[model samples]
Target: MQNISNSFFELLNKIQEKKKGDDIQQYFAEVADYLFKHVAIQAGETRFTFAEIEFYYYKEGEFEGPLYNCTYPRTRNVGKFFWHYSGMDICFESSEEKKYFGGILIRSIKRGSEIIAGPMRCSDEIMNSCDGELPYLVYCETACETPVSTIRYGIEADKNQNMKFCFYIEPETWNRKREGVLVADKATGRYKNVSKTDYYIAEPKKR
Candidate 1:
């Protein structure tokens, strides 16, 4: 098997190689399983802390205080990581609004001598685990340049919400953690992944 870092590309290759109608689905499933095995293991027996960072129109701001406070368990033997799809909240003053907000988790997995980590999808069980948890966030370990990915989900009303996106940032305990964005949405209260491609890096100046 090729490295999981290029799993997306590998999936495409598999699809091209196979002529079956369910080719895409089949390859996707295989890739998902492979990623889960590796990412979940690295999570190990440590307690993972999750927090959301507030973003104002593509600029990083203060930590968005924890919507879900509590260090979650990351048991290595679980064999899979739990995923929660939390809805995004957006804040606006007089003008400007978020088109939508969404997030994708990426992790690196060891394949023989190579470590591959890229954009990978979660399983139904994992995705459904975050039910009713709007703006949910999770921890990941990957060598991919961009670990956490976010996008706009849907449109909502303009209420002076605190911030726009609730991104999953580094754990407060990790001494060497880089910054990144997690999720986004408006006051609409609707949780659906929309499209707005912009990457946010964690600025050291802002604690």
Candidate 2:
């Protein structure tokens, strides 16, 4: 975990030095490539099979959901499975067993030509209180199962544009915890807790 933390900081330093122009898209693409190769790939080395990668664009201050998304291993179904589900307990169950799924969300922002990428903390709170749209460059990875070990890295800039970096690994029992069920509201499309009957399941729960 310590080594992972060190690598995240090193990557941040490298990104900080490479920011060159005003092309936000190009800059974000470069950052995403680095994160996939340097961070996500390395972290998944012995943990879980890499399923897919996704990039979400959130216009500044609008938190209802991402404006659009691009998925690697491209598919016609972009946001079908992922964005529709919220919470950590999401899984696929078969008669034989239950296969859990887990992933990480890395957020980034651009200030002038420079780019800063890392996990954005207190995401829910920020979305609710902020008055305007908040833009985000979010990198997402879907793994075959919840990883036994996980590391998170984030770099954020304050109102004054001072950058701060944070990195941490999940505790031993992180994978065993259940975050409960959240179903999308029919009227608003926002996720909300609901009774089991309200939850839609393609396969009925096994007896």
Model 1: residues with Cα > 4 Å off, grouped in runs: 1-12, 39-207
**Residue-level lDDT tens digits of model 2 in 14-113:** 3223322334334334433444433321122222112112233222122112111111111212112222222111111111121112122333222222
lDDT of 1 at 100: 18
Q: Where does the lowest 10-residue lDDT sum fall in candidate 1?
A: 87-96
TM-score of each: 0.19, 0.23
Tens-place lDDT per residue, model 1, 4-71, is 24443343233224332333233434534333332332122221122222222211121112311111
State in Å the error of residue 116, model 2.
29
CA RMSD of all predictions: 21.5, 19.8
Model 2 misplacement above 4 A: 5-22, 41-45, 49-51, 59-207
Q: Which ten residues in a row have the lowest lDDT in candidate 2?
A: 87-96
